[model samples]
Target: MTADPVVETLDALELVDHHCHGAVTADLDRPGFESLITEGAAWPGVSPFDSPVGLAVRRHCAPVLDLPRHAPADVYLARRAELGWAEVNRRFLTAAGTGVFCVDTGYAPDRVTTPSELAGAAGAAAYEVVRLESVAEAVAAGGVEADAYAEAFRTAAWEAVRRPGVVGVKSVAAYRTGFDLDPARPRAEEVTDAARRWLARGGRLDDPVLVRHLLWTAVDLGRPLQLHTGFGDSDIRMHRADPTHLTDWLHLTAGTVPVLLLHCWPYQRQAAYLAAVFERVYLDVGLTLHHVGPARAGAVLAEALEITPFRKLLHSSDAYGVAEFHHLGALAFRHGLAGLLRERLDADELALEDALRIARWTGRENALRVYGLPDGSPDDG
Candidate 1:
């Protein structure tokens, strides 16, 4: 069968990966690469091929490294080791066709590229999204007294966001205390006491009161707040990470700032429900896309879009520690989403123009709008 024209058009559009983390700068032997692909947070000795994402790497990413498609996992790792880090990064990142990467620099700071290095490898521009948990941890580690922790965190956050290239802030509240905290901003004494208790206990910042404080601080700053919600490695209490749990806080912070929900899966429907009802909320099924791979990406996208307003959906890889994810994510989102819209066009359910319009909106335009990037859509002048 001839390729669908809309699918071809999608491949040409430049994507703004609105949420992602830095790629590894090191050369990986087999195990090292496997750890990056899985959500396990470590090399667990189990074969990476056992997971969908790992299988996806062998099937789709092998060719990008100059091997045959569906290359054996062992063969794939050997070819990758032969190519070395820089070449592998250059090949996959440049091929991803991403025009911008909004990078979160907090996670694995030493192991991954800085935002600038990532831009250089991909031949694209990048911006930073400060991670709140990292900043709070730094403050606690600096010997800030409990009474001073609140101001210390605010000052640090302000300085961090003001640094050149930072466009937003992110919270790992889901991974820390979950969204089940008090909806109201904690009282002054509550914050001070909570800081004292946490600090006394070596200051982990997972204290519910302090987490709520960090989130509210970001909201008050008025920059976008990217919250990790649903399907994070084994660290999260999956049940408590539900976006629906944030409704009270959502109501509290409504109209203060945009809350971008990252990595929603198994709860895309819940996320879509929140997006449908809350003007300040937006979501991406990035974790779902990369893990499920291109073959099944459409079904997830379809579910997310079922009750979501078109404008509220955004694209992200949520990829961390690898450039292969950067490539597969963009490829899957563009290819899979376009294929879904193409099916509708063929059945007379959607016009050709409508299909192309939706493809451009979801893959490129929505991110530009949500992240406040220039609309420079060709039609915009």
Candidate 2:
């Protein structure tokens, strides 16, 4: 079949992956690789290799390492090992065809690549997105009095966001307190009490008041704020993760800073509604796409774009640990988005020029505009 001009345009465009994590720098065995491919636990007698994302790695990423399409899982892993970690990373990262990466520097349990390292591997420009909870937790670890906690966190967070190459901030409140909390910014006394009790426990930041404070602080920082919304690891409470719960909060924080809902899945429609209604709201089906793979990616993208304004949608990989996700994500986005736009063109519901423009806006332009990033050259990656 002759590919449409829309497909060809997306195929050649260099994506701006506005949200993602670093890939593991170390070589992995079968067990190690399998664990990173799924959001759930690795069960006895069950293999992630038999799953959708696993199959995608073989289909899309195998050839990047000199293996044929649909190579057996054993064969694919053997080839990846032979190529070594650096070479594997380079191959997949370069194959992903990303022009820029906005990396979340927190959440490194392994020796993963840094933003600069990831950018260098792909020949792309990279910037940082500071994690808000990590900063607040670090402040607690350093020990501050209850009355002083709010100021201390704001100070530390300011320093973190002011660091070079930081383009935005992120909050994992979905995993911590969820979006059901009071939308009003917590008062100073409320913050002090919450911090006092939280410091006594000395653990991860799951306190609802503290979480609310962290979010409000992001607004104060005045950088784009990325929130992990839906379909995450086992830690996520799916019901609370729905982006619709954020409606009241969105209303309270209107026009302050961009609120980017990341990895929205089942709630893509709800997210679309928010994006349509809120001026500062945006969303991306990032981590969701690569996991569902190319076959189902269109359906997911279709739902996400149902009520979403074209300019309000953005592209991301949210690829962590595995470089295959980096490549698989870009591939799925290009294929799925191109297909959707092409269909609209065929139905005369969209003019060819409008389809092409939407393709550019969603794939690269929207992210650059939202994050205030400069447009990257075609030679960037």
Candidate 3:
């Protein structure tokens, strides 16, 4: 008798990492950074296990602002070069088996224009570039420069979406950098105005807008919007990570823009709740797989699957830097998901098809639809 087509199918599918940060380094020393690249390229199961896709967010912009006051711009620029477009793609693609990479326009003035350059450098045949824009940053820099920035960002987004390998924009609204919403220090009007302006600038309908703006702009642009809904750095209060905060926004955007909740940190159950309740609310299991350890990751994925439709769930490595953290984080994510599926299904003697769906469909299919990419096997399609 033929064996059940479970593990084979699971292993056959490609992995679409919905969120990762490339072209950013945590280390200042050149040797240390190079070591990171070496380590990242050597992550296990990265090359042979499955097809790897990456959505590279620009990590240099805001994160740089948080660096120690003494750090010089030259140092920052040098670090960025070490984490340059060529090096990042080479390392990640070589190690992780990455086929498509969506590059973002980072926050820094110098690096803000890096996405397009990277796309050009990668030669569209190899990787996909997606430019990203931050609403809060534009608003904070309000003036002609803001307008110029908006125009530049809009141009990049449109170019990326239209380019051969480039994907659509990945709009980031809320972050620990205080770019999104902060109840204690709300920038609602600023955010709202900035979002409206961004939309008017011909931004794609699928990109996310932070906080209530996701709903506010849904009526005009009926597309998928990503939200940073889970665990983040220590600066962000865990309580604020609740997906419940976006409940009203989800309802408001009902039947309009789809919501892809990013992270969903310690509150995975709550993320599952939203996904279960709203067809438009999808979950991208990015940070949990990397930031959380094995045991916690297992529990969270189990809870999410139990409550939410597997179709609404997605995967992301959330890779940043060339360090061990980035490599291990991506590896742990895939491993954690595989392990969790094994633990859950082994008990019931269930087939691996469900796990495969979670791995492939949940991650890539939903993202493809949201980003408006052609739906086919990553290899053939």
Best by TM-score: 2
> Any runs in candidate 1 off by more than 4 Å, and if so which?
1-3, 41-45, 376-381
Candidates sorted by lDDT, best first: 2, 1, 3
Please provide, for model 1 over 68-98, each residue's C-alpha lDDT reduced to its tens digit, 9 standing for 90 to 100.
Answer: 9888888988888888889999998999999
Higher-TM-score candidate of 1 and 3: 1
Task: State residue 232's C-alpha deviation in candidate 2, in Å.
Answer: 0.6
Q: In model 2, how large is the Cα lDDT of residue 373?
A: 83
- Weakest ten-residue segment in model 3 by summed lDDT: 48-57
**Pairs clashing in candidate 2?**
none
lDDT tens digits by residue: candidate 3, 259-366: 677777667788888889987777766756644543355666777777788778876655544422334444555555677777768797556666666666764576
lDDT of each: 0.86, 0.92, 0.49
Runs of candidate 3 with Cα error greater than 4 angstroms are 1-12, 25-89, 106-136, 139-215, 293-296, 323-329, 376-381
lDDT of 3: 0.49
TM-scores for all predictions: 0.95, 0.97, 0.62
Model 1 CA lDDT for position 366 = 79
Which residue pairs in candidate 1 collide?
Answer: none
Model 2 C-alpha lDDT per residue in residues 246-342, reported as the tens digit of each score: 8898999997999999999889999999999999899999988988999889899999999898989999999999998989999999989988887
Q: Against the correct fold, how does model 2 do in TM-score?
A: 0.97
